[model samples]
Target: MLVLGIESSCDETGVAVVEATGPGVPVLRAHALHSQVDMHQAYGGVVPELASRDHIRRVLPLAQDVLARSGCALPDIDVVAYTRGPGLAGALLVGAGVACALGAALGKPVLGVHHLEGHLLSPFLSRDPPEFPFVALLVSGGHTQLMQVDGVGRYALLGETIDDAAGEAFDKSAKLLGLGYPGGPALSRLAEQGDPEAFKLPRPLLHSGDLDFSFAGLKTAVLTQAKKLGDGLEARKADLAAATEAAIVDVLVRKSLAALDASGLQRIVVAGGVGANRRLRAQLDAACGRRGVRVHYPELALCTDNGAMIAMAAAMRLQAGVQEAQPLYAFDVKPRWPLQELAAA
Candidate 1:
């Protein structure tokens, strides 16, 4: 089966095609993505209305691009899938509207996928796909969660962030330091030049005896430190960035290991945008390695929001017989849908 997927849950617009043959990992035929980073840079963050408008302009063209690259015709599409929730409502509507429209035109069945599920299942598209029953650490834009994933549709929530997620901590801390838009990467880059121990930072809830994470306190600590260095903030920016990154990484690494121990799962899969951080990957790899645990991550290209993950996730759900593509074109999106909800789907 050939599945075409659309992702417009936020600032990026993505489209892709996947081919599923029999009961195995689906193959990514082709994918295209257009980031709205440049567009949203001036505003310091995503503008929902602007993002929705950009999706309107980019989705179809990206769809055409993916089809051409994959050498597939519109008539060959078997299923049309789209990220239906856990994102900006306007952005979700764009993808949902387009996907349903295409399904209606082609007489193909339509599937509305959970956005976080796309990120969670994305590792299946990697070169070394993980098997069932692994713990997943999702560090996406505003979400930080730990889940026990048994299979395509079997996910149990282990823990999640109560306030700001890890990604938010990075971005918020970066903004406080005068780093421009796309703060996570910017701060990380600056962190490479400074000593992580240069400034003391808090590791929130590091000893809470649970898997849940809290980065809001860390961001607060950063803000306080930044203010204390008001006169010489520019001179100490790199050191502060490094210290903040170290604090966040320390909590994550320790908590992940704790989760692994608690679940007794030897394998863990890291997904979502923050999973792309080199520091996080390095720390997790080293820590998990020492504990005789295996760590898996989506390819760098798939780290961010993308249609490939959505398509792969939809195909997997069908293969697992947990869900079905419906002929009904009417759809609604859940901007706050939880990943655990799919456990009952």
Candidate 2:
């Protein structure tokens, strides 16, 4: 079965084609992505309306490119899958409208996939795909969560952020230091030059037990430190960035290990944009390695929101018989849908 996926949840417009065979991991024939980062960079962040317009302009061409590269035709696509929410409503509608329109035109069933589920299942597309019954850490711009994933549709939320997510902490902290838009990467890059112990940033909820996370206080601390640095802030920005990265990474690594110990699951899969953080990956690798626990991550390219993950997710859902694509062209999106709600789907 050939599953065509479309992703326009936020700042990226992605399209991909995946072919599923029997009961194995689906093969990604081809995938393409167009990042709106440069466009949104001038505005400091994503403008939902602009994101939606760009998706309209880019999705189709990306779809065509994926089809051409994959050596597949529109008629050969067995199902059309799209990221259906927990994102900007306008952006979500663009992909949904296009996907549903395509499905209607091609006489194929369409599936509305939860955006986070795509992130969670993305590792399956990697060269070393993980097996079932592992813990998953999903850290992204809008969310940070830990889940016990037993299978394609069996996800149990173990913990999550109560306030600002880890990605938000990175971006917001970087913004405080005058970093440009899409600040997380900027922050991480600068962090490489400074001492992780420079500014003594806070590591929120590092010891409250349970598995919940909180980073809002950490962002506030960064703001306070930035103000205290005054003119020196410019010179010490790298140090501050390193400090902030350290604090966040410390909490995440600790909490992840705690989650592993509590669940008795030796393997953990990290996904979403923050999962692309080199510092996080290094720290997790070292920590999990010392404990003899295995860790997995989506390929860096797939770590961000992308069509490949969505197609892979849809294919897995179908293979597991947990859900089926529908012929209904009428569709709606859930901008605030929680991953837990997906367990009921």
Candidate 3:
């Protein structure tokens, strides 16, 4: 079946076509994406209203590009899948509106996919993928969670952040150091030349013995250090970046290992934007390798929000016999939705 997936849950608008032959076999025909990173760069963060308007402008053209590139017309699509919730309401509505309209016009079925579910399944799109019954660490700007995945649509939330997400902390700390928006990548780049031992940053709740994480205090620590630096801040930026990165990586790796031991799962799937952190990946890879476990990640391009994951997720849901909503079905976005509440179709 040919599935058209639309993702506009956040700053990027993505559209893709995926073909699912059966349970474990899926092919990506084509995908297109439009990122609003530069658009919001001036603001130092995403402005919800601007993001929604941009999605309205780009979603259609992107869809057209994907369809044309894939040699598939609107009518050729069997299912229209869209990210339904867990994002900015206006952003979600843009994708939902376009998808539902297209589905209705083409007489195709439409399925509302959970945003994080798409992230969780993204690793499978790779040639080398992990099987079911794995641990998933979903670390993004808005969320940080540890989950146990037994199958598609089956997830058990083990723990999550009690405060700001790791990615948010990274961005916030970067901002304090005079780095601009989307600080994860920018700060990490600076950390390469930084001396990790130059500054000692606290690893909050590292030995909490629970899966839950807390980076709020760590971010505050960076603020305090920045204030103390006074006029010498410029010279110490890299050192601060390195210390922040090390502190975060340490907590994440330790918590991930603890989760693996608790779940007794040998395979770990790291998803969401923060999964693209090179340091985190390196640390997790080493830890997992030492314990005879494995780690999986989406391609770097797919690490953030993209339509390919949504398309692949929709294909999997269709293969699992998930049902589509009615043609007249219209629902608002969910700014806060629990993953465990998602039901199999």
Candidate 4:
């Protein structure tokens, strides 16, 4: 079936068309995205109101682009899927409104997809994919979690950040180092020339023996280090970036392995924006390889928020018959929703 997916859970407005032929088998016909990163860059972070308004402006045009590119008209779209929650309230509503309206107009079914679920299933969109019963490490600006996946729509939260997410920590630390907004990528780029041993950063909750994570302490450690360096610290930026990256990667990798061991899941799937981190990928790849386990990652571009992942997830959910028939105006955005609460369709 052809599914139209809409995503506006964050700064990016995304739309895509996907087709599902069988269980765990989806084909992407076309996808289009509009990122408000530059708009939010001036504010150093996303402004919810601005984000919502932008989504309103872009979602329809993006949908049109997706349909034109895919050569599929409204009638060809069997279902409309949209992100329901765990994001900015206004942002979620934009996608929901458009999707619900489109579905109603087309006399088709609509499904509200969990954003993180889309991230977890993203690796399947790749040529080389991991099967069911795997561990998923979701690391993004707003969240960091480890989940056990037994099947489609079956997820068990194992561990998550108790404070700042790994990406947030990276961005915050980068700001302290004089880097501008969206610091995660900037910090990572600097780390390439950094000496990991130049500065020592704390690995918060590294040995907590639980799935929970804490990066607030690590951010403080970066602040303390910066203060100790005082002036003329520009030369040490790379070293600081490396240390921060290492510390964050260490905790994530260790906790991921622990989750794998606890769940006895040999395959690990990493998702979210931080999943694009070269160092994190390398570390997880090495750790999993050493343990004789397999690791999967979405294509680098797909690691960040995108419509393709949502489209693929929606197609799977539709194929599984996990959908609801609700009025177009009955939509609501969930700013905080747990992944474990979703039932397999």
Candidate 5:
């Protein structure tokens, strides 16, 4: 089966094609992505309306590009998949609308996929794919969660963030440190030059005795520390960034280990944008290595929101017979759909 996937959940517009043969993992034939980071930089964050408009302009061209690169045409598409929700409503609508329109035009079935599920299942596209019954640490844009994934549709939510997620803490703390938009990467780059122990930052809910995470308090602590540094902030920016990254990585790494113990799973898959963090990866690698645990991650290029994950996820679902593509052209998007909801789908 050839699946065409579209992703316009936030500031990035992506499209891709995946081919699923027999019962093996799906392969990403081709993918295209256009980031709105430069466009949203001036505003310090994503403008939903602008994002929606850009998606309108980029989605089709990206789709065409993916098809051409994959040596396929419109008529060859078997399933049209799109990120259904848990994102900006306007952005989600763009992808959903386009996907449905295409499905309707081609008489092909369409599937609405959960954005987080795309992230959770993305690792299968990697060279060293993980097996079932593993833990997943998802630290996407505004979500941080831990889950026990038994299979394609079997997910047990172990814990999640109460307020600000790990990604939010990284971005917000970077903003507090005067880093521009797309702060997480910028902050992480600067952290390479400073001492992570230079500043004392709180590790919120680190001892909560549960898998749940809380990064809001850590952001608050960063703000307070920055305020105190007022005049000296510039000189200490890198140090502060490093400290903030350290604290966030600390919580994520520790909580992930706890989740592994609770689930009795020796393997863990880390996904989403924040999964690209160098500090987090290094820490998780070091920590998990100590316990003889296997850790998996999507290729760095796939760590961010992309169409490949969406297409791969949809292909997997279809292969597992867990979901069927719907012929209905009409659609609705969930800007706040919970990943756990798919457990019952």
Candidate 6:
């Protein structure tokens, strides 16, 4: 089956093609992505209206680029899949609308994929794929969660953030440090020059004896520390960035290990934008290595929201016989879909 996937869930517009034979992981043919980072940078955040309009302009061209790169025509695509929820409503609608239109025009079935599910299943597209029955750490956007994933569509939430997510902590902390938009990566880059132990930062819920996470306190601590730094802030920005990253990564790594222990699962998969952090991966590698537990992560390019993950996820769901593409054209998007709901999907 040839699946053409579209993703306009956030600031990036992406399109891709994947081929699924029968059972097993699918093969990604080609993909194209356009980042609205420059557009959103001026605003220090995403503007839904601009993001939606940009998606409208970029999706078709990106789709065409994917088709051309994949050496396949639109008619060769058996299913049109799109991110249907858990994003900006207008941005989600753009992808869903385009996918439904393409499906209707091509007389093919359309599949609505969960954005986070796409992230969860993305590692299957990597060279070294993880097997079933593993712990998954999801740290994307406004969400931070740990789930026991038995297989495709078989996910049980083990724990999650009670307040601000890890990504939020990164962005918010970076913003406080005078970093611009897309602060997570920017802050991470700056942290390399500073000492992770230069400043003491709180690690929330690290010893709570449960799998749940809380970064709100940590973010507040960063704010308080930055304010206390006064005119010395610029000289100590790198140190602060490093300390912040350390605190966030420490909580995430500890909680992930705890999740693995709680679920009695040795294999762990880390997915989402934060998974791209070198420090996080390095620490996870060291921690999981000591326990002889396996860890899987998506390729750096696939860490963010993209159409390839959506296509791969849809193909996997089809291969697992958990979902079927529908011929129906009418479609709706969920801007606040929960990952746990995939158990019922």
Question: What lDDT score goes with residue 212 in model 6?
Answer: 86
Instruction: Tell me each candidate's TM-score.
Output: 0.99, 0.99, 0.97, 0.97, 0.99, 0.99
Residue 294 lDDT in model 4?
94
Model 4 pairs whose backbones collide? none
How does model 6 fare in lDDT? 0.94
lDDT of candidates 1 onward, in order: 0.94, 0.94, 0.89, 0.88, 0.95, 0.94
Candidate 1 lDDT over 114-207, as tens digits, reads 8999999999999999998999999999999999998888898998999999999999999999999999999999999889999888899999
The C-alpha stretches of model 3 lying farther than 4 A from their native spots are 322-328
lDDT of 4 by residue, 147-210 (tens): 9988778788998988899999999999999888788999999999999889878888887779
Model 1 worst lDDT run, 10 consecutive residues: 336-345
- Model 5, position 142, has a per-residue lDDT of 95
Q: List the residue pairs that clash in candidate 1.
A: none
lDDT of 6 at 189: 99
Q: Which stretches of candidate 6 lie over 4 Å from their true place?
A: 343-345
Report per-prediction Cα RMSD to one decimal.
Answer: 0.8, 0.8, 1.2, 1.4, 0.8, 0.8
State the lDDT of candidate 6 residue by residue for 4-33, as single tens digits.
Answer: 999999999999999998676799999989
Give the Cα error of residue 181 in candidate 5, in Å.
0.2
lDDT value, candidate 3, whole model: 0.89
C-alpha lDDT of residue 200 in model 4: 78
The weakest ten consecutive residues by lDDT in model 2 span 336-345
- Give the Å shift of residue 98 in candidate 3: 0.3
